[model samples]
Structures are given as C-alpha cells and as structure tokens.
Target chain A: MKRTITLTVNNRPGVLNRITNLFSKRNYNIESITVGHSELEGVSRITCVVNVDNENIIEQITKQLNKQVDVLKVTDISDQAIVSRELALIKVLSTPNTRSEINALIEPFRATIVDIGKDSLVIQLTGESEKIEAFIELIKPYGIKELARTGTTAFLRGTQRTSNSTKNISIV
Target chain B: MLQETAFTKMKADNKPISGSELLLQALEKEQVEVIFGYPGGAVLPLYDKIYDSKILHVLPRHEQGGIHAAEGYARITGKPGVVIVTSGPGATNIVTGLTDAMMDSLPLVVFTGQVATGVIGSDAFQEADILGITTPITKYNYQVRNIEDIPYIVKEAFYIASSGRPGPVLIDIPKDIATAISEPPEEKEINIPGYQPTLQPNYLQIRKLTEAVSSAKKPVILAGAGVLHAKAAAELKQYAEQQQIPVVHTLLGLGGFPAEHDLSLGMAGMHGCYTANMALYEADLLINIGARFDDRLTGNLESFAPNATVAHVDIDPAEIGKNVPTEIPIVADAKEALKQLVAQEGKLPEHKEWLTQLQNWKKEYPYFYDNTSSLKPQKVLEMLFEKTKGEAIVVTDVGQHQMWAAQYYKFSKANRWVTSGGLGTMGFGLPASIGASFADRDACVLAILGDGGFQMSTQELAVIKEFNLPIKIIILNNMALGMVRQWQELFYEGRFSHSKNPVQPSFVKLAEAYDIKGYEINSVEEAETILNEVFSNNEPALLDFRVDPNENVYPMVPAGKGSHEMVGVKP
Candidate 1:
C-alpha cells in the first residue's frame, strides 16, 4: 500500500527546487506539494506528499533533508492522526440533463456550487486526501471541462498545538 | 520575566535597545566573549554595538585570517569558534576559511552584517547575499529578519554546530536586525522537524565485525580522522591494544592512535610507513574506523587490503558503502561503536609471528629521510619534537614537509596534531598555529611549512603581531612542491608538473618584515643552535631552514601497489 508522507517546508524561492532536486537525486517521485504561510512570522510551511517504497531510502532522505539550510524543519505526518484536505474546483459540463446527476455527486461530497453558468457548474470540495481523490475518480466519467487542485493542507487530530519536533521539516 | 519587563521598561525607560544592541546582547548571552572580524560601511551598526559591548573583538589583518583563527581555535578547543564580518567583500573574504573548516569538519559560527531588511534584494551598495555564497559550505545557515529572532538563531547555530558532525554555521544579520531591540532572549529549541540526527550503531553488524576481527589470523586496525573527530582516540587505542591489532593511520587520521604507542604504525598510503603498508597487505581483516578510503589511502582500490575483510565504522552513512565497500558497515560514531566492540569481544590472543614480522619491517626502514651533508628537513622535524618533547601542538602545511612531519613527529595525544588533510590546503599552518597558540596560551604551537606553502598565507603574521601570539613558525625552504616533484621524478620523468616554478620571496626577510624574530639554518650544526635559541624564547619566532631540494619522501609503495613493492632510496 502506498502511503503519502505529508511535509511542511519554508515558503521561499528554490524551496520547491531543493525538495524536488532531493527527490530526483534519490530517484524518488513526489506525488504532490502544497505551499503556504503558517501562524508564525518569517516562516512559511510547505506540505509535500511523496511516494516511496523503500523505507530506508525515505529515512535517509529525511535525515539528509534535515541537514539542508533552507529547510527550517520537516515532519512526516504519515503516522499522525490528522485531517488532510485538498481544495479542487471541478467545472463539469452542466447540460440541463446532467445538472441533477452533478448535484447528486456534490451532495454526497458536501461540496458547494460556488459558481454556475448556463452550461457549467463550479463545485468546491475539501476533506481527507483519499475522499478528494475518490470524488475526482467518480466525477471523471462526467463530461468534465476542467479541474484544478489547491494541493493539500493538513492538521493534527488532537488538541496538541503543533509539535516541538516540527523542527524536522526540511524545506530543502 | 525581567526580559518581558525590560521590553516594556525599555519602551518607557526611553532605553529601547537598537536591534544592533540586541544582537550584541544575544552574543553576550551565548558567551561569545570574542569575535574575530573586520568592519565595513554596511556593518557599521554592528560595529557601533561591538564598540560599546564588553566582548573583545580581534580585527584580522584580513577577513580570511579572522575566520581561519576561528577555525584553528575550534579545531584545538573542540568548541564552536565564532567570527563576525561585514557583508559583501568583508564577508566574501571569509569563504576560504569557511571551506577549510568545512573540509576539516571544525566547528565555527560566522556572523555577517547584511544590509537593512528593507534594502535586502534591492542590490543595495556594499550588500551581497552572504548566505548564498556560504550555503554550500556551511553545515547550517540563517538570515535574521527580526531582532527578536537573533538570540534564537544564535542558539540554534551553536546547537547545530556542536551537534552531529560539527562544522561551520553562518548567521547573516541585517543592519536593521542587528540594531533593533526587543525582550530578553527566549528559550527556544533548535529543532529540525522530522530531522532525526543519526547517532546509533547496529549491534548485529558490529557483532559480525567482531567475529571477523576475532577470527582473523592477521589483522590490523586502520584508524582515521573520524576517531579524532569523534574524540575516540583513547577508546581506539584501547580497542587496538585489546585485540593487539596494529594501528596504521591515514594522513588525516595520523593522531587517531597515540604516536608513542608501539601498536601505532604511523601513516600508510603514498607517504605511508613501509611496515604499515606491509602489515595492511598481510592483514586478513582490516578494521577501518572513521577513515574514508581516500584515493591517497587506497592508491589503487582494487589492490587495497586484498586479503582483508574490511569492517568500516563511520558517523556518516553515505561514507559507509561509497568507497571500498565494507564487509560490515557500522553507521555510528567511531567512539560510540568502538565501545560496543569492546563490550562484545574481550582482549585478543598474541600473534608473536605477526608482531615480529612487523617489527622487522619497521627496523629495516626506520623512517629516516636524512641527507646528512647539510641540514636535512628530517633533522628540523626531529629537533622540533625533541626540544618540545612533542608537548607542543604541531600544525603543518602540506608538501614534502608534511610527509616528514607525519613520519618523524610523534603525537603524544590526539587533536593535538592539526593539518589540512583532505583538501591538502596550503598556507594553513601559520594561521592555524596562531589560533592554536591563542587557544592554549601556555602551549607552544609549531606552524611547520615548506617555502611553497608558507607564501600561501604568511601575511597572517600581522594577526600574531596584533595579538602578540607566541606561536613558532618553522619554514622548510625547499623552493618547490617537493612532494609533487618526487612523484614527477619517479612517475613523470622529472618533468615537474605544478611542482617547481618561478623564484620565490625570501621568507627570513618576510618574517623580519613583520618585525618578528627570524633564523636561517644552512647546515645541520645550525639546526641545534636555531632550536636552542627559538625554544628558549617565548616570543613568536620563525626558523628558515635551507634543505636539499632533491630529497624525496621514502618508503613509497609506488602507485597501485602494496608494502611488498615499496622502493626506498636506500632500501
């Protein structure tokens, strides 16, 4: 089973390059990445989801990443009980015949029709990564016009603020 | 509490500390009593605070010397050394020292004053991204945007520097941040999220290593700078003695084993001991500790330790499987893992035949490179050690002189012997000597170098003059890169490649130019006179010795061969 390791990095130029460079050098594939600022000043957190089969290589890369200077810290939220969400807006064709079908799909996902034109509908959804992916898989059969993902944003499940060990999140 | 109150008190007390003041205060809190630096327009604010601060600042003759002194101090003291410089050229001057410290793994923290926050990235005058230039070399780096973050960043720099494989850390403080004032420094954890530093050894793998060593008929221990870096010299000596394993150090690992110990086989490889090379070839198991198998160490890797089953122990995992792949790779600090080996395997049985054979080889090639017609370079080394009883810390610049020092000078202790081993940096000895001498004012730091190497950084004498440091510098004036020439002579048909070149400056006059005492030795008789005069004096002195240019490092095992193929000039 493939598990996504979520990571937060400092938002800065070449940060994505540093992270991707690390993955490429190690021959590991990055599934996705989301960058944004945190509650702290002069700090930006980047959430990266990567794909790796070799645990040893993952552990080694994580150790190497922590050594990079741009990387403020790195945390693998893979084992943590957390909520991971992706913001994606799907503009599926809304012909008069398919409007009911699209509404039914949106109803199950608890998505909203943020915008609607005569021939299309813009639905916004947020939830666990798997749920978002599943929604995309289910809605793909519909005559979809365009799709855009806002990447992923994650948070811990408990009342524990963030973590002292978040220092491990390597930006590079 | 006072810090919080101070933030408000300063606001009301009309004593709002400038960001620069806070920068100095943070340094003071970190116990940074001295910072080697040079002031420029961009860092004027930091210089202003430094003026009022109690911290002593050593203005280097050059910014490079400031960083180098910090490196020397760190290498000898085992503490992270700190240096400060202005941005742009002032900061750029420190790169060589940074790279030197990086290559050697010496701990250092550099503080560079950057342009104000608003002016950053605007291509402001005298402003350059010091962080960008240093990022590749430093173990960690930071640019403080907020004055409040200065203390935290300083704390983190120290933590990161001394932790793991200690190396240099750079802190780029903007003029605004350096001058801004805030609350008292907060207690912050220097954390790298998910950055779990590797610090454990594999017991099962170590057991396999133990078995390999314990069962071997002929075994020797190859120790390296890692043992010195890990401060495991005593343990390494203990383990080598426990197994009665002969210990041969690479040039970098020279002081890993006690030089005076009978088990210590000195350096092995290009300029290695003939006996040590023989023992390495004869060994059934080679237990490598903290030594990277550099090309010089493994002249030809295919023939390196052909009969040996290698058990490698290092702190960096990448080094484990990278070179001369090991039979058992233990990813742990040498000091820590050696303790495990001791616990698992008890003292070893005697190998009378092996010991006798090694002794015979040692006797045959007694590590002498004397061409007694005049003052030999070897005699200068002998006299230096004899006068000091090897009590002084010896730092050498690389060349024909380095091989001689490694062969003749006995290291009574580890970390006491310092040099630019991996990068083979020249002009390192003088500045390193000044730093070493200053670090331990009581001890003599002998900066030994060849004519070629001395010119690389002898301008640092002004640093010694400024500090009134008493480190002695001994120059072996051979007028050529003799080590390189030796290779060219033997391998390249005497057509010197980057070996011998144009006429050089007179070093004795060079020392006199700095108003330091200088001595010139032209014969063997002058060596004893020079030694007596120099050793009796407490002032910084220089000894210029004229030695035969034709002398080559002996017991060389030719490239791609072992001890059996060693060709000594007299042997």
Candidate 2:
C-alpha cells in the first residue's frame, strides 16, 4: 500500500538524516519532507511524505523515535483533513510586460513580490499544495531563474485541534 | 499477465522491506511463546506487529522487572528468555537485569528498538546509540540494517544466548526496517566463524579426577547451581556415597544434596554448621562440583581447606581458576563429568571418621530457633515443610530468611531448591517459583521471600493472579532489608544505612488486590494451623508473618575471616 507519514520531531541535529536513512534503509522512497524549528523552543516539526506498504509501520517507526528521550512527539498527519501548504520563492526572468501579467496571475494565489529587477522577478506564495502547484505551473512559463520550496505542512479541519495530544504524546 | 498491472506485479514479488516487519517475523519464526515489553517510539513497529501476532505478551510494571521474570523463566526451565523493549531509556533500564543474568551465567535474549537509520547519527528525539551501551555486558550484540538479516540475527541471538557459558544477547532493531517489506526472507543461518560452545567431556581428565577421589583420605563433595541445572544430583549423590564422603553445599547448592542424608553437611561457610565448616577447613581433598568458590564461603583463601587438593568440574572453563586455584580442572558438563567419573569404577575410600566428624558438627550447630509464645518465621518454615512433608519445590529469595530455609528445610533429593546464590539476588523467588511450577504443573511449589525482596518484584503477583498456579508465597515481613541491615549492624557500626525502608506495603491487601488467597499469622497456633490449611487447600496462598525487627542470623563469620574467627555469638 502506498502511503505518506508525517512526523513532528523535536528540532535537533541529524533528525532529517535519521529519517531519510530510515526510509532509504527500508527502501521507503521519501517523496518529500518539511522540517524546521516550531514555535516551541528546542522542538521542531517534521512532515515526511513517503510511499510505503504499511500505514501501521508509522506507529512502529515513530514509537522507536518516541523511545528516544529527546523526542517529544510523533504523529501521522497524512490522513488528516486540513489545509496543506508549501512556500515557494522563485526568481523568474521577467520583462516589464510579463512582470505585470505575473503580478496579476500571482494576485489570486495571495503571493507576494519579494524583489524586482530589470532581468528577474521573485515571487513568494503560500497556499494549499494544489494551489501552490498551480502557482508554480503558472510561473513556469516565464522561465524560472531559481526555485526554493518548503514541503507540505498541515493541521486538522475546523476546530479539531491536534495540539493537546501532541503536547503529551498520547499513543492512543 | 495483461490482467495484472506493473504495480501489482511488483507487489507480488518485489517490494522494499522495513526493519520492523523483519523483526516481527524473526520472533514469530523463533516460536517465542511470550514477550514482556513496554512500548515507546523506537520499538513501536515491533509492538504494532505484536498487535497482529498470536504470541502471548505481558506488560510488566517496569523494564528491569520484565527481564527479571524472563531470567527466572530461563533459569527454571533451561530455556532462552526473550524481552522486547524500546530504545534509549527503555533499553538502558534493562541493563541491570541483563547484568544480573550475565553474572549468574543465565541464558537471556533482549531486543531493543532503535531510531531510524537516517536519524540515528543526528541528535533526533528519543535517539540513543544502544549498541555502544550494551556491548560490554552482553555476550553478543547486533544492529541489523537489512530485512534479510533479521531471521539470521535473531536465530544467532538465541543460539549465542543459551549456548556455552550462557549470558545475554542483545539485538537492536531500527524502526525503519520494521516497516520495510521483503520478497521472502532467506533461510536464516549462522555464518559467523569459530563460535561453537564446548560441550564434550575430557575423558583423560575425568579419569584422573576420579582416581584422585578414589585415593583421597578425607574427600568432600561441594555442589552448586550447576548440579541442579545439569540435573546431576543423582549421580553426585551416588558418587559421594560410593566413596563414603560427606557433601557440603554453598547457599545455591542447597537442594543439590539431600540435607537429611548422613553425608549432607547442609551448607558451609558463614552460616554453616560448626563441624561442616571446620571439616572443610581441614579436609585433604575437595571435590568442587559445579559451584563457584564464592568469597563469602572461602575466607582468607590461602587458609581455606589448607590441606585439600581440589578437583573442579564446570561447563565454563574460565571458572576453573577464576577464584580458588584448582589442583585438577575438568571442563565438562556437570552431569557428563559425574557420569564419566562414576563409569571409571573406582574403589570406595575409608571416611567413617570423617562422616562422624560431620555428624558431630550437625549435632553441635543444628539450625535452632527459640519457640516463642508467639509466631516466628522459623515456625512458619517448619510448618511449611511438615504440612507439605518436603514434597514442594521450595524457592527462597536472598536474605536472612533464605539461610533459615536452607537450614530448616530437608530435601529428599537434589534439584528441588532454587535460590539466587551467586548473585544473592532478591526478587528471584517469586518469578522463579512461577517458572518452576510451570515446569512441573502438578508439583506443589512454594516461594519464600522477604518483605524487602517481595516489594521489589511483587508486581509479578499479576502473573500469579492470571495463572492461579497454586504456588504458596510465604512473606517474612521484617519491615527492612534484612540481609543488608544485618551486615550494617555487624560491619558498619550500626548506622542503619539505607537498609531500613520503614514503611511497608500491606501484603495482605496486595494479595487481595491480586485476588489471591491471603492470611497473616501473629500467633504460633495461627501459623501452624493456618499453614496446614494453606498447604492442604493447594491454592495460591500468601502468608505475611511479622518478624522480629532486630533479629540477626547466627553463625555470622565476617567476610575474609577464618573458620577459627567465626563468631557464633556477640562478644
């Protein structure tokens, strides 16, 4: 069975390497993962999206991490119904005419203009994954100069907060 | 074939496997009956698989207690003990239990879950490098990366654990591998070179040792746990009688020799009889069978049995000269070595005078207890034997009460007594009793534990409750760590160190909580009559006897002191 598992690990060194190694060792192809320091000190959230055979193995994989004293919490946000977003900062080659059209196209996606130059334009967009993908697709026509994108991060649907459980690692 | 998609084709034969599933299959293949575990992140996959498996799993109150039960099971039945745990803290908690089993030379397999491979090097949450931590203590250790290696690693772990000078083997399974899939694991095999445990008896050496026994003027046989584990009791008993020599035992050596026999010296050393210790101090020949010469027994080693020539038999060759020097060392199984010695057809020696000497010592010391107007633990032990008539397999946890049981209880044959002698391990009796009763389901097995030791692993009462196996628990409620307290009083100027943990759990209430039969005896009549009822009923019973607070075990010879220096009383 193909599945993606999201893990919120403490922000610490080697977590990315360890998670990637976990996938590589098991041959779990890591499609993408977004990780960074969260609002909490000494803690980080990691969202790993992978295609794998068993969804239950996430429990096993994360439980192993939970056994690590430093690891605060692990969760699978894969199936949660929520807004998933990725931030992309792309520098596109732009003429004044295309830049105007680019700014117009970026308007609906709520992207921002970070920089402007005679030769290039930089646009930053954050939205649900599908919207971000559409924004990237629209800007691809301008001939991309540089692209840096943070992977998907999500939270549960209307008023269904996952914060309390994460605060005190409840396995059930 | 057109009917099946490429993805389906790949799913049928080729797929990436994780370390977790491999671990689960390996355990399944080992036919592991049960595992005791408390789940955390690193081992979550292993637990997840456990959820799907049919194997029995016990959740212990603590990690150390989990493996202690495993050790007890292994020691009692001669099987490999298996415990599963998460990495880091969970894995580290089990080290003491592993160490205890290692010191006793027991067979145990401990499996710990590790963080994923990629996150291991990084200071990832909950990550601990367990392989580095357990290397010094374990007999063998492995960290598997590939799913194909799981079956092989687990098979070898069990083999290395139970074979030869038995000790613990640890396997660390990374979480990622648990989720990995394999095309069909390879036939598991042990491929490491030169790892065979020695099993054959050395015939020439056995012949020489037998000759020495035949020619000795004052030969005494000393048996230990090896005799019981190897089931060499009958051979040892016949051989001693044939040669007409007395048998002296270590604390662990108790039931390996019949306490009531003419040749039986019960136990020797600190608490041993006046004659047995004195005779051993003067004997011309010492047949050390299966028991290590613990320092507690051999005071001033240079002065111990000064005239005796030693013939040692043990499975571990390293133990032959590890402590007291051996005149002749035969590295072989205790049962096989004894069998070979018996097969040599040697003539019996003349030791009636020596036998008389031990008999005189038996009369002199004769493990005594004052018959008070009220109840005493001695009376309970006496009643336990009389009511059961020495038919029960009696287990004693280490402490003052253990020595008392060794002295008062009579074994018609060997292998019926199981105690943690080498380790002097507390909390050994209860779980061992469970395992022993499991071995002989029809036999009446009783565990004698102190209040201190009972409190340590009393959670095993849950197991007792689940099974209702008719094993009687006799708790000597002294309200202190009796053994350590005795030492503090004798050697530490009586400062009353941490040995005194004054507050005690209500054992009767605890018994009720487990829903087992429970009673308390304050009067001698209550002890004798209630004990008879507990024994006759044959249900699992617990007897909490409030004992004297300041009572000290007699025949106390401080460590490193000679037999002449043994203090039978305070100055």
TM-score of 2: 0.71
Candidate 2 predicts chain B with a TM-score of 0.90
What would the per-residue lDDT of candidate 1 be over residues B1-571, giving only the tens digit for each residue? 1133333345455565677766666666666646788888768888876776667787767787788778778887778888888888888988888888887788898988888889999999888877667766777678887777776788888877876677899988887776676655555777755334466799899889877776788888999888887889889878887888889988878777888788877788887888788788888888888887887777777777888888888877656655575788888888889888888854365576787888777777678665647668888888888999988888888888988998899887877887887778777787778777767888888888888878878778888776778788888888788888888999989888888856887777888899988888898788887788888868888888888888888877787774457678253
- State each model's CA lDDT, in order: 0.78, 0.74
Which number leads on lDDT?
1
User: How many clashes show up in model 2?
Assistant: 35
Name the weakest run of 10 consecutive residues (lDDT summed) in model 1 chain B: B1-10
User: What lDDT tens digits, residue by residue, belong to model 2 across residues B273-312?
Assistant: 6666777787888888887788877766878888888888
Identify the candidate with maximal DockQ.
Answer: 1
Please tell me the TM-score of chain B in candidate 1 relative to the true structure's chain B: 0.92
Residue A85, candidate 1: Cα error in Å is: 17
Candidate 1 clash total? 27
